[model samples]
Target: MEERKQLKKTLKPHWVWAIAFGSAVGWGAFVLPGDWMAAAGPLGVILGFSIGALLMIVIAVSYGQLIQKLPVSGGEFAYAYFGFGRYHASFCGWFLTLGYMCIVALNASALALLIKFVLPGVAMQGLMYNIAGWDVYGGEVLVACIALITFAYLNIRGTSISGFMQFIFCLTLIAGLSLLVIAMILHPSSSFSNVQPLFNPEIGAVSAVIAIIAISPWAYVGFDNIPQAAEEFNFSPKKAFKLIVIALLCAAATYSLTIIATAVAMPWQSLIAQETVWGTGLVVENAYGTIGVILLSISLAMGIFTGLNGFYVATSRLLFAMGRAEILPRVFAKLHPKYETPFVGIIFTCLITLSAPFFGRQALLWVVDMSAIGVTIAYFYCCAVAYRLFSWTSTADTDVIVSPAKKAMTLLGLISSTGFFLLLVVPGSPGFLGTPSWIALFIWIAIGFVFFMMKRKDFARIPKEKLDYNIFGKTLESESISSNTTKKEA
Candidate 1:
């Protein structure tokens, strides 16, 4: 008989922290602040993000508890299975995969966008066809593909290399951005007078903060990535919550600080009016010329790299977990003999992202917009699962009863997650998805249902016991719960 394969527990707390923090603050920090500033002025943007980050902390509490309880690779997939059944697990896995894969692709294209900002017209060479009004170019495609390949290879090599790289990149990103922000603050031209309006006139103070809050799902996505890598953590699961909370605080500060840095540098109103390709870069350039651009470029590159690397780890691990549970093809679960990495899933993510550059950034944005819905759904699942699993107990033993406070918090997370989902899908809402994104979303849901039908019998016959073993490494049990519910509760 062959030995059952397992993922190595090589992830230290720092690497895990890197995966959480580095993933949450991606290329959006450097590139999108100007758009955010335009919609909401510096104070509005900062306050909105600060509020959003706090809400995310509430949602993350459920996730932290689950990581402590489950400690599995599939994240919400495993949680959904334990709480509901295989059907919900399949649903959770399908949508979460969309969110992760789209971000992986989105990050690659962000790299191309970064390059174009650094060297104007360089990515415009060898004009390819245009999609959704954004032209594709051979130069941009080559750059994105090269990045996809390099990161895929690194992931296939092993988590240690990728995790270490992410840690180093995150540190360098912090250092570079710190220097750039400090330079912007100290430059002779910078002035408090430049920030004339603390809030945008068009969006209104209240409305502007609301707008920033609506996009919170996208801005803080990389942190939930912790649950996906929980199976690899070398430390006690007890420590996962601490790392997640710390990472969340860091990410919140980074998003808020980046905007402040840009707003303080120059007159953001004029920068937005000019509509430069990259307003943040332009701000730094106006402050210190070539030297400022170089500093910003290095920072932006590191930000992009961490996003790319972090999502690659996330997407691959989710796919690997699903495959091991027979939710995907068995091949996706297979590991590289030498490196013991999920090479198949890693390669699959790379191949999927490689095709994204061809569609142009405009087209890709539609998918990303749709994907926020997918991630919100996953958040809902995690909180719901946590609530059901921890709220009530089956045993008569007083010690086994979960605290009322913890139970209430999970319910709050569930409700907030549901709100996040509604903000995206509810028509007439400020954060509602466009027609294209809605169409893509329905099509994706339809496909998930169809795939479920094809595997319906297999899912039924496999037995939940076997699934627990396959996905969780053993049949998980808690002394307080017998069948996730007690006769008294039922």
Candidate 2:
């Protein structure tokens, strides 16, 4: 009870939106646009993202309903726990946890590469070795390690400080993108016709859109992070729902404009042919020279930081939830006496992130694809759980009411998420994830299976009375009473 009182609710409504939006945008905005444009062409990429946004909207509705209804820290895990059962909940939470860690690793590699890009020979001076064809450097690895530690420390200190940093980084990214778009519009050399090839011959129009859709989940994965921090929100649960929707919409717009600006500045064919994947930087350099590179690089830092920091917060909370439930080791549930943060989880996550920089960027890209698969599966499961809850709760009085329209939306989310997952693994689909991605997915699943066997007894029988009832992580008397009622009903 004393420990529950230590977890404070300090995140404001706006901060919730900022963190979600910022996390969703991430380093993908700057790096992946070139590939997205190449795969789907400018028009096709835009159309695909629009379609993707609609699909996400459906999923967001389900998440909104669940978050408001549960108002718990473990977002997806909590939904699965209440709707399905402990065993299913652990599976859902474990997969999402793996997905979040993959993303954190992805961001770490991206950060190291970005440092090498901006700093040049400074980090690249000593070629430590080679991994998967990319040259590894001790200095670059050091930079990434330092960054990982910094983010972990920030989160360990407290959520309030971390949330504030997220807001600032998000604003900086928005400002940087705004400046670039304005500059592109004003450039005398720029042309709207540069986006001419709406679909490329190599991937075709349908395939292009499908490819974008295949990766869309990762590009917009941050909205789900909102629910992980639900216990920290200061406003009503309904506001948290609205903020998620708003954040995704904003992310969709930001991505479209960023792609358009890049496309208008440089032809898609030219970008595809570039030897380096730093297409966004090259486009900015083409339009505004060194000044543009510097601006975009700064924006890139903000984008990368948002994903790194937001996911750091998210993955730790996830570990905390699982640990508290005795699904994972209880060490993950340990909180700092002074900060009341998940210090053990944070450190464990940081140690995992330490591996990504060594494997280099290409390896992390495959890891991101694998992460997308896991996230898609988790989304599919959550949609199933959400739909079930909608049916079961009709007669129950709950804080979050699911209307007929919301119910329909949840069904739509289930269909779309299922379809998206199929597109990833289906044999003949245009967006069939490649061999490496599948291999990675299988390996992750195997590891999870091993862990599950070790905890089989706990999974077979969960102690509902022993479960933490302070959904908001607060020790209010009313919350304890409500929790008891909930456990009794269960």
Candidate 3:
């Protein structure tokens, strides 16, 4: 059989960066922190944002180093394969893909929620009618399902088109955020007092720090997304790293300002009592009236759509990478003959995402929190790999340099991410209440290990030397020899 043609490496640097930003910005800015704040209080939100952003930078930088060293489509899986082994890599890839799918579903559900704000009367009336004995939210679920299907179809139609759509959505989101900033600045109630220090001396600084780190996990949620685009990035790890940083900065600024604006415009007591996810929208409405609410709802909906599309892209690529390594069914590796996209995997992901809305909003949040746990586990592993690559290795590879600053950052990041994961697993915490996220991860990894042993012979065919680093720097002769040997042996 003829070898399958590789995907076209056509995404520009800007789009690559936008994907990372879009993935991080989604419903997270509007929804996630409020939930955390409600649970912990304003003190928690303040501490969480500060510490979370700091920890996120460490993980992003480590990933930057890892992607520079090994720019492959597998993200955490690719790093684990080289640093640990095929089995470990497969486990990371599978979990990461699963997490992305959950994010996609979460985004879809958020979009549905936003729709109610935009058309409350219609939504409420639909709920009263109780089509199929459900409610308007059920109708919203149907709408979100349709939206996911439409995007999946669009993605299969072509990568360039999908990328362009994502670009437009991202630009619209940024423009909407800019408008929000202007509105908040012009609001009669706006003041710097909204940004008061969250932790007082009486709060016990050390305990406050721990609480902040625990809450901040929401802010660092999307950093793993960059590595998933390795193939589309032409293997340029440095460029990818810059994109991740830029995205994180944009997200942090938006989050900090949003929190401050909300606190300033609305009383802390009222904000804390908000049980609805639409609290952000309510704040915008109060600040600027109907137009402000419309803009906020539209921006949030766009953010969710763009985020879902980005996650679809990343998750499909991750599955494709696993399939290429024979850890998953070969069908997942198949590219559309004309579009050169992973059509099957994308379709499957959309189906899963569409089905997820039935779980209700809180249940959906629990799923996302669980997925976040998986991502944190992946980040911890990536930090370890970064430390190993930088400290223990003597190779002349620029990507592996162990700068004292980077080392310190990586160590801190490792500690923060690991501790955050433990916090998530605590009873009464988001990940602990419903399904134990850690337990789910363990079961998922075990399944991957079983599959790895079943296909150990196929994995052995690809030599350790060839798989050690990304396909970027090797000489032409070395590439040819490895390619020929693998083909002949297979």
Candidate 4:
């Protein structure tokens, strides 16, 4: 008897891993913590980083478990459909798509800032002067727009090209981090005293922790992005799980080292007070003079571009999945025959991302705050679903086996996500506004819900079997078929 091999359609494992790492190392490393530090100081940095990392681990583990079960392309949307229902799924999809788009824009803007720092005279005066007829912020916006367009074109070409670009950028980013770390180590005055707290304010500890949690969530936001690459893993789920854990460990180490280096090299107060939030260049310049600034600037530019590339890829996929499921217009689902990529989605995302420059600091802060709330909401849903899945599965099922250790991790994740969610909703806190971001989120969610209801009939037309398999699992196939048949008759 001749046996046939099941042909697998998937992305290379290395690319999947690279995307996960690249996604996490975005503007969050430089900018996210700075915002937190501004509110909390050096101690705040340590507190924020530790708490954020812990919460992220929980989110990541829950996501990892969910991916093993579903392994779909839509990330949270897919998870929500299975765990909750159509309404929640659509809400998550729309919210996550918006967040990713905003992140792309944010990274692009940061890249422009980096360019201005590197070549102050040429990049600033020549570029900004010619484009907007103003010497405003060195024309980084114009440069960012150009870079966004170029990257969008490249991404529209294929995932392989985008992955390659991320690898290069990741390397450049490492080099930049290395330069800063070395400088801090070599400098005599660099010490831990700057970050060491003499006395913890008795009254403010709880509030400070809450504030830190709200802003720090940004640093660990992208760890959940790994599950989105489930369709790309070449190995078994077990191996993929191990890989993610290892990668997270590495990321933690990298972040911890970078923070230590930054703290040691610069006065905590000075670093916090600096108007320009991208402190890597300043750290470098402080250590190695002019040459350090040039190197750091180049590295920062590459890192921003790489992060933007990741955002583009992730959001495009989310849009593509929404289109495929008919939650979005079918036009967004169109893939370029030659490129085998979602061309329309990419173009749309890029165009929307260009709005970053017009958004001043206040608007930018609002966008970030709103996006963070949305992401935290999604994380909460994911954790809740994980808890349910763990509880509902049969004890004897190999696939559903829940170790004490696994359960503990999942529990911790759920707690952290829930706590953070509550923190975000509380008003008058440092680094967060309760009602504004929540109101923004509600408006977005309402829009999605309205669209879902309008298309409810079309969604109904989809075979219940498909919906069930898509949302729940193959294990629920029989139930799905029965339910759909009954609905049809009704």
Ordered from best to worst TM-score, the candidate numbers read 1, 2, 4, 3
After aligning candidate 4 to the native by TM-score, how far in Å is the CA of 115 from where it should be?
2.1
Identify the candidate with maximal TM-score: 1
Clashing pairs in 3: 127-136
Clashing pairs in 4: 82-471, 124-138
- Please tell me which predicted candidate would have the highest lDDT against the true structure: 1
Give one digit per residue, the lDDT tens place, for model 2 in 327-430: 88778777898998989989999998898788877777776787787788778877876775554246544433456776788899999999888888899886
Each model's TM-score?
0.95, 0.92, 0.84, 0.85
Model 4 RMSD in Å is: 4.9
Task: For each candidate in turn, give its C-alpha RMSD to the true structure in angstroms.
Answer: 2.5, 3.5, 5.0, 4.9
Candidate order, lDDT descending? 1, 2, 3, 4
Q: Weakest 10 consecutive residues, lDDT, candidate 2?
A: 470-479
lDDT of 3 by residue, 1-490 (tens): 2244256776777777677777777877765545544544456566556667767877787888888866767788876665656556766776677678888888887777777777765444344233323343556777678889988998888767777877888888888878887777678887646534454344554554566566455555665767876777654667877878787777777676666655666655566566655667777787778998878876787788778878888888888777766667778879988788989889889877877766666556655666767787788878877766555435565434657778877787788778778877777643343454455557666876686788777767765444443222232223332344345544
Worst 10 residues of 1 by lDDT: 481-490
lDDT by residue for model 4 (404-464), tens: 6677777887888777766666555554555656676787778777877898788768764
Off by over 4 Å in 1: 1-3, 392-400, 476-490
lDDT (CA) for every model shown?
A: 0.85, 0.80, 0.69, 0.66
